[model samples]
Target: MKKIDAHAHLGYIGGWANVKMDVDELISLMDTYEIETTMICVLDNEVAYKAMQKYTGRIEGCVYVNPLEPDCLDLIDKYVKLGFKAIKLQPLRHAYCADSEIVDPILDKAEEYGIPVCIHSGHPPYSLPWQIGLLAERHPNCKVLMIHMGHGHGVYIDAALKMARRYPNIYLEMSGMPMHTKIKEAYDTVGHDRIMFGTDTPFHHPTVEMQKVLMCGVDEQGLEDIFYNNAKKFFDV
Candidate 1:
């Protein structure tokens, strides 16, 4: 079955310093691992757009918007019109709380566009599962993709699962999450349809991330759902 990376990024993040992967490098990695598609974002929209244009059908562009920007919603509109299928909100990097007013307009725009909003989860203050849950509760029409599934930590993993179990709109993304038991718990509790594969590439290897899911002992249908079907249906890619 074809695999779709639900979360990925290209280009260096100056703040993190550890994150730095150009489109060429990413494509090489994807090719090595046989990843047919990836939902990716970048620090520079133009670069991302160009890469998307260059690698059309293999990369699904996500409009990575900082809620702190004055024209954030406008930027989102521009990218969406340009063919971005989803919205990526990184509250932690922007130094804003996930539940703050800063993200409300972004969530509103997501509802208007009828696209999935992939939020950075599993951290503190800004990217917790409950905080994302608040957005889901408020925006019932929008689909919320929880990136990291709470960062593979103990408490947050349970929190992520609890939120996914409680909110029908919430989808669990397995990236940066290391526990096989937790992955299995997410599958058993949220059902295979609510789970999607991601690597958060450059931070985690796509093959390693795939191995985490495969080792969970997921059946063929479940593998299909987690690897490609759910994401293809979620983003309409």
Candidate 2:
């Protein structure tokens, strides 16, 4: 099956303790794990654009912007026109509530441009899964991907599942979840089409993440959707 990583980062984290991801390093890992494609977000828009341009189909760009920043919508439009495939909102990192009015414009632009918005989940008061669901409810036309599926915690997972079940526009990006049972549960509860596989690469090992999916015991069709088909449709790659 052709696998696409729906979530990844190409920048450093936490005072440069982690290695910064680059085109060669990302491609090397993709080659190692046989990942056919990846959707990457970076703090630097120019770096992301350059990486996408250099790697073309192998690395797709996800526009990362702070909603509170001035001309946020303009940047989103500019990057989308430049071939960005999705918009990433890190409410947790940006210190904003996902359901707040400030984020509405970002979500609106995402809908306007016909692209998905991937939100950081699990963190409460800011980026909770339920808060994202509330936003999804407000904008039914928009596609909202809950990255990490609440980071695999039981309480957050329950909230994520509840949101997924309640809102059809809400979808799950599986990564950083530590157990296969959660994957199986999500597949059984939310169905395969709404769930997409992701590695959260550079932070998590691709091989280990793939193995989690493999051990989930999903049927072949389900595996196909999670591995490639769902992301292909969602990201239009």
Candidate 3:
């Protein structure tokens, strides 16, 4: 079956000794893993744009927007015009919540453009699930994909699942965190189709992430949906 990695990071993670990668090496890994397509984004906009341009066919680019950046909406507009499939936000890195007033304009723009937004939603310094839920409530038209399911902790996962159950616009992307049981629980609660497969590559292995879902004992059709079909439908791939 064909595969599409719905989330991945391609830029340097400063100070985090474990997570570091350059674009060339990432592309090599994608090729090695037989990933037919990836949703690529970088912490740096210029680098992301260049990498997107470089791997135009193989990667569906998502532009990163720093909520603190001045004239951020203009940059988002420019990239969306450049054919980026979505916008990426790191609320935890910035110590901001998803529903913060600062991000309202960004959410508005995403709704206006009819594209999705991916947010890092786990652990310290990141916004919690309630914040993400509030943002989704405020912007019902915008599609929000929660990265890591709030990092798989008990409280965050519970909040995330509650939000996904309440809002049609919210989705949970599986990556980085080891949450096989929680993922299965989410599937049982929200249905298998609501979850999307992601590697958070360079941190987790794509094939291994896929293996987690397989080992969950979901049927072949459920596996196909998570591995590729759901992302295809989500991004119109």
TM of each candidate vs. truth = 0.96, 0.96, 0.93
Model 2 — which ten-residue stretch has the worst lDDT?
11-20
lDDT of each: 0.87, 0.88, 0.81
Q: Which candidate leads in lDDT? A: 2
- Higher-scoring candidate on lDDT, 1 or 2: 2
How many times do residue backbones clash in model 2? 0
Per-residue error (Å), model 2, residue 118: 0.4
Residue 55 displacement in candidate 1 (angstroms):
0.6
Any residue pairs clashing in model 3, and if so which? 92-125, 92-126, 121-150, 122-150
Pitting candidate 2 against candidate 3, the one with the higher lDDT is: 2
Q: Write the per-residue lDDT of candidate 2 for residues 1-237, one digit (tens) a residue.
A: 679999998867765456567788999999887789999988788898999989999999999999989978999999999999999999988899999889889889998899999998988779888899888999999999999988857888788888998998899987987777777788889867898899887888888889888989998988888899999999999
Clashing pairs in 1: none
True-structure Cα RMSD, model 3:
1.7
Which pairs clash in the backbone of model 2?
none
2 versus 3: better TM-score goes to: 2
